[model samples]
Target: MTKDEFIQELEVLIRARYGVILINTLEEERALDLLTDLARKLNKRLLTWSCTRGLVMDGNTAVHPDTVDLMTAIAKAEQLAEEPSLFVWLDLQSHLNSSPVYIRRFKELAQEIRERMPSNSIIVGPLMEIPTELQKEVTIIDMPYPDLNELKMIISQFAQQYRDRNDLQIDCSESALDALGRASIGLSKTEIENCLAKSLVQHKRITGEDIDFILEEKKQNIRKSGILEYVDTEKLETADIGGLDNLKKWLEIRKKAYTPEAEQFGIGWPKGVLLVGVPGCGKSLSAKCVAASWKMPLLRLDLGRVFGMYVGSSEANIRLALSMSEAVSPSILWIDEIEKALSGLASSNQSDGGTTSRVFGTILTWMQEKKSPVFVFATANNIGSLPPELLRKGRFDEIFFVDLPNEQERAEIFRIHIKRIGRNPENFDIAKMVKLSGEASLGDGVRLTGSEIEACVNQALLEAFFVRNSEGHPEGDVTSADIERAIVQSVPLSRVRKEDIGYMRTWATDNAVRASLAPESALSSAPESPAMAEVTVGRNIDF
Candidate 1:
């Protein structure tokens, strides 16, 4: 929520005489500033306290320093029968729940303050720790991070501060300021200040380039959260991924879904797609491509990390992660290997005390009701582990089954990997490798995944890299012979998990959209494709 909206709400609550308000926030200094302003507007005295400061007046002038103890502060607050007033306890939650006596005293003080003259007490801290006894008396308010307008205000102020400086310049345009505001959504005021200063120092001017520095700052937030990973999408391109033509086409159609023109055309933001099928078949890579292709930040949600040990902690962590994603709208949330996170869903009630069920339910509900531009790209290899509710209609906009690459896709994959490593795809005879392998009869090469093909290419390159010619110099180019040997040495997942792959194909045939549109000629001639053979998997693809 914006600072103004928060102040309006606080005004309403204070007017209605809410006994105590607990604000959960990381921005303690910003929250205190808002409270002080609110106090002045409402004609109330503002008193601030800390374990060390001991109940100071507005946190500057001390009042009875002997009352440094929390219990004494609570007692003094209860006795304060002055005009309408607000007492803010800064970081009190750090030690508020450690002792039963402190919790009881807090409850008593809250009840007493409610009966006294117009006065309110607020506990401001990052952690939310309200004892059951005081849950009824204390109201919790989650202080949202700075919104776009506030961020813009911060930027304007920052630029204004350097208006007199002769060495530095502010080269920000109006549009650039808007973009910076959008990029700085999830950052705190202090973080924005520090980042703006860093940007000026690094480039000697604040311009569009600072957005990259701001993104780097956000990476620190992701690292600190430990649940969501900041995926670097700068190097990823839709062209880097081979095949999944259907999926690529779908993504391209909606590439402008978040644009203003689309909004004017009355198109709602695209929800997202769920990719489920054989492992190493480009499901996860597509997630990265979606973000890079559409120009959005990529956040990888590790559900396993969201499950916390404390009671109610798991739910809170998921809430925080979702909120963080929403804050950075027009972004992509990539949940890789989602099925593994929900592995215990079948017996969640008996196992983990229903924590898994709760977390899954939270995600399901969010996916259905969320209006944010945060598109979710979830990939799963173990389809059976996924609950029916997740597969039901409307949960995800579409579910695409990423089957193994066909012969044509395998060739494309080989070309992409080979080209990426500075080698021309035409340098090697990919077709000869396909025909000579001789194991091309099983399901028309339905087993060749893009990853395995890349592996084959890599193996061939390694052979060429180390092998010495008769002249003793390193071989300059990879050959069909080298590729054939690599393909022979490797075994694709299709043959090893043949039964599982067949089951998946059967399920996907009726239940999901196909990600590939393999050419009939390639499928017919190769039959099972070179991937069926043990001899030529080609270049290695690393995620």
Candidate 2:
């Protein structure tokens, strides 16, 4: 939802006679504009109160300018001098911890508004919490981040207003404006404006080149909190993902889910996915792929850093991190190795007085209840250490088991690594190396994972670096034999922990969706088995 939609929703709440409302937002000017429009629509007066400015009536003038105290402002409103008015309180949440009587007074004011008055009290702040005393009396909602169209308008207006500036140039083409708008997706109104200003001041032009500058701005904001890292996925794309076609097909459908047309069609936002699989598979890479494929900002959330030494500080840090994430919505939040962060949940109370448990609970609650378009891409080595509450149906949209790369996926991985090293796969017999790495060429059913395949490619290059041609000159080109030797000498995770892999595979057979697609040979005919059916959900998106 955008600013206009928020105003319409607020109008409904006011018309229904809701007494007290709490809006958690940092856009004070935007909120004031929304409230002003709401008041005009409802035919009510707009009274804004601040800690320093006291209480002001519909206009800027105040009858009693000394009504700066929160209690004094509430007392004046209780007298109902303005029968139908919106009493907006600013910086009120900061004092909720200083005194308890203030909570009681707010509760009574809510009751009085419902029973004896026609006005409503609005408490606005960057961060807010219900005092538990007025939990039922207060209705809380978040002001959503600006959508694409709103951002486009912000850019258009700025460009027109500053077109005559001699120092800075602007690109007002429709395509360029649309690109700028999409680039500013997760930023606030102020941040978007700041990005354009910075681009002009630093580069002398607001063009496509400012994308990097704008992203740098986002990274600076994320770094201030020290929990989430804004990832740069410029080099990563869906094609870089070797396999997980099952997961790929699922993700491809939701690539455009955040568009306005999708919302108009009543399409629900995708919650998230849990990837539990082999250590060397593409679980982590898939997170980067999804963010790149969706054209959304990627944030790496380090859950371990959320803990603090002070009491309740850990919980507060997690909340702060999540709040920042929501502020940058229509983005992807990647939590790699989630099991390590949540491994202590079972014994959290005995160890640290439930700090981990509380932190975990806060995350789960937000994952389930968040209305923003933050798609969580969490990867775990195994699910044994994860709390059962996290595995419940509502926590994630789907749980995918990313197994070792199959023959086709292994071949793709090899080709990708070879090209990275400036070598041609065709020169190295990738097909033969792919067969040698899998069970096709080996009697034992051994297979290299995506990471192991890349490793084999690197080791082959290392071996080839020392070999000399007939004239004693170095033959730096890798051969198929070098890769085969590396494959034979390597001990993969599948072979090292055979029993553990068996257990995980069995669990996934029943509980999780298979990530890799069936081999091309198997799909030539019909799916003969149920496992193949699950692995090949639908045709992969080739385009």
Candidate 3:
């Protein structure tokens, strides 16, 4: 549920359970204001709980009381015959875990107050962990990140303030407002307000560029979580990826669902996509490229980072990471090499004494129940190693098996790599290169990625420049020969893990994973079952 809904529900529950209520939040300074408002609404006496400057404010102004100590404050509160009084304990929960005497006294005071006057004690802290003894009496409410409406209201307030000061007129269009709202998602009110103040001061005017700045700030927040890495991909688009046409189409269709227009039309956004197949076949590349293609921010969730040393810290970290991702909706969450990260969970107790299992459970629960538009792009190299719970239908929208690139895809890959290095594909014979790297020989040589190919081209260009200077001849452009030599020298993952690749191909085809390639293309390149050539009298078979 949203933050507002959660708060409203808490308010209702508090009213139902106890005649008097205390509402406090983790927001340090804002907690006082919130509690004051609650006190006014409930017509209750406001009492503060603090050790340093105990009971500083009575209602509005500071009225230092005689009883400032914790025991003294509790005694004063209990002695009062007020029908309803809210005792707001701020930043006191942190001390409860370590101080047993304080916890016992607080519980006894709560029990006694509930019987006499309609009084309730609320504990507020950055992190909440209720002991088993007080869990029955306490009601925990999650204060979620701010929503778009709240963010928009805050931005408009800032804009109006700016216009008032400088006599600057700014008319925010729907698209501009949307950009700002989306950029501010996953940020607290204070954070967004701070960003707006900083942006206005820096740019002298809030424009679309400010929206990008806000997104960068949000990325920094995600990075601080330590579980998710905020990656800035350098213009890597779907076109940059040569293979995975089916997967590309799937992502393209869902990209539109993130727009305001789609929301108006009541179109539900796609949850996620699972890429499972052999390694080095653009699975991970597709994950990164999809984020770029959608024009959304990319957050790489390293599952390994979620496991913490503390008992419950791992689960808490997972929740925080997922919460942050949801706050930044319409974003791509790439979990690269997922199988390896989760493999330990299969024998969790034997491996890490059930910590891995608990972490895995937390992740699985989030994936299933999450309502955010954070598109999960999970890539698994070994499907067998992945837990069966992850392979279930509802976990991801569709499971796609990305096989080795076909001849057409291979040619596109070559072109993409060549152009990436500032060399036109027209400068080289791409068709001949494809033929030379066909099925049998290509398995080893042509398995080079766009990145590896670019590196080879760079090396070849250096070699060509040196040769021209030494021989006193014109510098020649890098030819297919250079790429061929690089291919021969470099070993591809396909060559090293041939058996593994073959096994994956057979598994994908047998299990009916939606093939990322065309049917004819898949049939032609049967890496699992190679076709044997028959000899004829007049005809010859070529390898």
Least well predicted 10-residue stretch by lDDT in candidate 1 = 534-543
lDDT of 1: 0.79
Candidate 3's residue-wise lDDT over 1-543, tens digit each? 665685677567656644223343446555555566766787777777676656544545333555556666666667652557667776576566777876777777777766666766766566566776776667666566667776777677767666655644354666766778878887777777777777766766765567767877887788788898988875788888886666676677788888889999999878898888766668878877878778788899998888888888887888778877887877888999999888887688997889888888888888888877888889988877988888888888877777666566767888888887788888887766655445456544235544455566677667777777888878466788877666566666665777776677666654535434444544555431242110000111111
State every prediction's TM-score relative to the real structure: 0.92, 0.77, 0.88
Per-candidate Cα lDDT values, in order, are 0.79, 0.80, 0.69
Clashes of each: 20, 0, 0
Instruction: Give the better candidate number (2 or 3) by lDDT.
Output: 2
Give the worst 10-residue stretch by lDDT in candidate 2.
Answer: 532-541
Candidate 2: residue pairs that collide? none
**Per-candidate alpha-carbon RMSD to the true structure:** 4.5, 5.4, 5.5
Model 2 RMSD in angstroms: 5.4
Ranking by lDDT: 2, 1, 3
